[model samples]
Target: MAEHGGRDARMRDAEARVVGTVEFVLDVRVEGMVHAQAVRSPYPHAVIRAVRTDDALKVPGVLHVLTGAELEADPSVDPYFGSPRPDQPVVAIGKARYAGDPVAIVIAETTAAAAEAVPLVDVEYSELPYVVDALDAARPGAPVLHEAWPDNNCGSWRLRHGDCDRAMAEADRVYSGTYHSPSASHVPMEPMVCLAQWHGDRLDVQTSAQAPHAVREALERMFGLAEGAVRVRTLNLGGAYGAKTQVKIEPMVACAARAVGRPVRMELARDEMFQTTAKHAATVQLSTGVRHDGTIVARRVSVAYNAGAYALSSPGASGQGLTRANGPYTIPNVSIDCVATYTNTVPTCPFRGAMTSQLAFAYESQLDEIAADLGMDPLALRRKNLLRDGDVYPTGEQMHDLHYDAVLDDLEHAIGWDRPPEAAPPGKARGKGLAIMLKNTLTPSRSQARLRLRADGRVDVHSSSVEMGQGASATVLQLAADHLGISADRLVRGFPDTDVTPYDTTTSSSRTTYAMGLALQRAATDLKAHLRTLAARHWHVDPQDVTVGGGSVARRQEPGADMAWEELLSAADLAELVGEGTFAADFGLLLMDDPHDVHGPVTVHWHQGGAAAEVEVDLETGRIEVLRMHANCYAGRVVSPHRVRQQNQGCAVFGLGPTLFEELLYQDGTVSNPNLSDYMIPSILDVPEVITSSALESDDPRAELHGVGEMALPAVSPAVANAVFAATGIRLTELPLGPESVLRALDERRRNDDQEGTTR
Candidate 1:
């Protein structure tokens, strides 16, 4: 076979995708299918007195208008739905929590007809007091979104490792700072879409879902249906960076289909996509205690995430923030309190890196500040406190498989950390900075897959791992080809379907490569065993005496007993043979009852990464230009080194938009810039002159595959901020470090310097 796992291997579906032949959820249509449009609320916080859909029903081509009250009264299906908690309603239940909240669905023969009727569906609301900020929402008397959570807190977690109080008191000096990160949208190429149809009480859903099994389970629970009644399937997703995790529009579309007695498809408009889900806007307060020698003794961190209007993934994301708020350094005493507070805006979900990016920016930037106070190089200080193998983590578990040093070393060399700063243009100043971070994969999850050997000698691998432009399908095909000793072109892969493919927890957290890859490996091994058995029976030899390799089977003792896979299968008179396998993470308690105590073994493995950047800041215009960036992540036993580097580089550039210019501009608790025209992402002109990425591998034979998808993201924001600070002696504690903020800071600094000069 042509070099196993070659770097030039292209995705199996790349050509189809490029040619626009691949069918997405939006392209799916069936007989008698209809379109749906949501009538949204305009007020951020309000009580829904009534939803009058009489006018909407009178419009031409309008079939039906379904409201939350009707579903609640039906008693057949529950209107409330959310992940980790049943808090979000399918439509505005008694109250509309945020602007753009769907109060009713208008189904019509066409999308335009449904949209035309949406304005006619009137909703009366009584506006209530609202809080848009996390810290403000968490205060004593804020407008509470849900009565169950009186304090406006959606979720809360606290981690206390050692005695932080005593460590702070005994320390030589202390430092404190507060940081802020704004909420941002995913802006995937394909907006959220779902199509649902019911066949005589059996629910069938075709959606752009990252977790088909989870979506099926949720639908079954919601509709009170049997396990086998609800079927969820997915096509290739254009992109889903945690925005399409469990369920976005599936539940609502399913409900509409059942109500209308026809196939209903709902495609979120570009503006509506912004209101569907968002990244958490967070505020972090950090206090560090250090000795005169620059050794960090204790760190106290308090973080509040703005989980707008509902509890989507905030509970789990907040817990993650609590665990990772402490930097990659080895600190003996650490106290962290991370809470998700309810705000009147779009509900927040996990972005690419979840809560790690927000936490890394706070701690890493502060670490550089601490180094400056001690008159020491930031790199030297990081080396002094870097966590090593067998170090005790705050979760009371011993950490192993650490490759932070290798990652940092690669970044340091790539960015020339030891070299002096290059001369900048007359209007610019130049400097360099670096950052390191740690993240955990989703724990206690499971993945199951199946392999089938056809009579034609081609193998089929069935898995529920969604292919969301992340090369999941490609990775599986490559791994299976090498393991089964077959060419990649001979492998046929199946898309994620609840009826055919088995269960997978979700496609987020970068866990598919390791978890699903292992599942396929076991399945391939099982297939090999079955092939050996068939060959042994045909040749009248012991099963162990039959060897299976290189797409052929042979009896070990006889030279003429060898047969190819197709010949052996024909001899056995078998049309096809199948095998199954599964992989489940070590089950550990994720949360504990005690507020100050957390369970051990939180993640399957730690994902480590580092990023370095050289930037030139324009003193005249206050604009920042990235000259170059180098990012690397630890990938134990890499399956595709090329893919790892691509992911690392893409994540680093993706991180730049949020760090420098991306923010969901909000006006009075409403997203003001929801379209691409107003919201700026990284265009070709914004990318750095030089961008490079690589992967660090371990020599240990026992090393397993580590995910590189999200590891590089958390390091990006901090690295850029530190570089800007080094270029100019000004510190910025907020995200999206735009030119306006930089100019304002510079003006303040100039005024202060003038005052000091006058005194002299």
Candidate 2:
């Protein structure tokens, strides 16, 4: 199994065998199944005085109408996010906090009738001034989005490590830049959808989710029921790019279903999906004090994450933003002040790249400016301060099995970074950029898997981790087959059913590979031990003496007379032999007592990643596009070489969207571009060659695997940005690098150069 395909087969198989998309067929045979529709608000902030359904109920198919006042449900709270200021409600009880907030739910015999009836349900509201920018919200006497929090400041955090002030004072030069990272929608191919069946004491829910168990837990808290009483299942999820981590409309769907005493299904429209769960932007200010030789003396980063409407995942994201604020540099002194502020747009959650990508755009671009000021090679300057294994972070998290230096070394030859590339014709020049990044795989992250061997010799693996188009399911199968001495085809992976599969934390954090893989590995080992026992009982030898090879259990004395997996499985007592494996979030042993860790069990903190990008800029138009990208990360071992590379590639592209494109524009708490036609993302024409997704493996014993999904994205934007600066003298502060911004920068550069009488 280890040598089957060597480098080529192991790494490319997952991409080749992508599990096809979901297929759903709705059956309309129930005696009186009703259809539902909602009429949402047109304004960002408004007070809903009443929701009248008398006109809608007159329709022939209209069965009933549902309003916030009719529902009997309690609100829920999350510890990670603070108590909702102004004390938020699940359903807009009286006032709609943000745009798209559901004030009422209506049910009818036909969906078309319901759609027609939505226009009939009358609602009136009084509008209020809203602040969408975190900075604007933080200003004194700013319109209070959440009246409970007077200042609009949702949360704040600080990290003080080493001597930052001293390092800055002794520096020979200083670099300051205020980089802006904007918010964008998840915009998955499939909008959010959920179907719930409530029968007396039980609630059975099915939906597209990254974490089904989390959904069940949320329902248990909301309905005040035992965890065992609620169930959530995922027959198929269209796509969940960190957008479906928590319960969104599942509770409402369940409540709606219970009200009429039947089943209900609801799906979000694209605009509502965009407004509900998009990655919020941040206004980051970074000041790097560097020594004469470009040995980064110190970095002081102040990051403000716009926690748009509610406290979804902004604070947790800010903490991570601070940890990665200073790229992978080996700066001895660092200080970061991170705050996630409440605004009136939309609550933010982790997207593909999350905060690291935003932070990278700031730090790495600053590095290039610093290098240029010192008249040093940008690549060489990076090498001078790159981190190695055993690096201590701002939170005292010691990174083990760190291979960032190796990744940097490997990238030089792969991306042709050794020599200078030529510039564009006349006005355009080219420069290469590189940055290293890391993310936690199991910081309060964990996964459990169950493997069963059927009497027919097939391996059935069960885990609740949803495959959000990242090839997690295939990776687990590849790992299980390798560990159990079985073929990949013989193993089948199934996921997400609270009543069936084992526990697994959310599929974000790139934790699926490390956490779920561990569970799969354990299950494989257990099955291997069980197989060995079966062989030993027949061979009349000790189980310890038995060995498994080529999917067969062999006795040391008589190797040829071994038992194949088929033979052992046939003799098993049960219809299927089950092996269960559970893994808790692991961070080696170094910084187990981290003061910043508010979650339960604690351990050492470790993350590893490296990526380099080279780009070409059309100086005449100030247009920049990446030529190729190379990446290496120590994300434990390669379970499925094919799937892992695909993951890194996907992250690289997803990361690119916000770096050079994609922005959520807001005016007075109202989202300007709530639709995709306005918000641009990288398409086929936009993606680079992506020459090498080189991986640097780290063998940290404490951690099972490492984070990979979001890590690759953060660095590329900065790399491309720095490369653009190298090509042109203009350093961009805002994102999307649109034509207007680029041309404006060019004009500014031309005027400055003319004034100085300098020519290229």
Best by lDDT: 1
Per-residue lDDT tens digits for candidate 1, residues 1-760, read 0112235477767789889888788788899999998988888999999989889899899999999899889889888888787899888899999988899999999988998899999888899998889898888988889998999888888888899999999999899999999999998898899999999989999999889999999999899998979999999898988999887788889999999899999999999999999999999999999999999999999999999999988877788778788878899999989999999999989899999999999999998999888998988888888889999888788989887777778878899999967999898899898999998888878999898889998888899999888788888888788778888888898788899999899998889988988898898899999999998889888999999878899888986768989888899899998878889976543545554577577888888998999999998898989889888888887788778878988888899999999999889878899999999988888889999987877776457888889988999999999999888978889998899988988899999999999999
* TM-score between candidate 2 and the true structure: 0.89
- The regions of model 2 sitting more than 4 angstroms off are 1-33, 72-88, 531-541, 548-554, 557-561, 564-572, 586-607, 689-692, 698-707, 754-760
1-760, model 2: which lDDT tens digit per residue? 0101213234233443365424421221334456566667666778787888899889888777777766533243221112222234446666676776667777766778878888888888899777777888888987776666788776666667779999888889888889988888887877887777776788888788887888887777667788778888875456678788766767667777776787777767777787778886888899988878787878898888888777766645666666667677777788888788877777788777667777878887788888888999877888888776676655565545566667667767677887787655676667777776655443666678888888787888888877666766656667677767777787776557898887876887677776777788888788788778887887778998899766778888875877767777676555766778877755531233542442222232346565677777776776777888876565555555565576677767776787776887776656778787887777988788655686555444344455566666777777777777876777888887666787899899889889888654
Q: What TM-score would every model get versus the actual structure?
A: 0.97, 0.89
Tell me how far the alpha carbon of residue 188 in candidate 2 is from the true structure, in angstroms, after superposition. Answer: 1.1
Error of 2 at 508 (Å): 1.3
Best by TM-score, which number?
1
Candidate 1 to truth, TM: 0.97
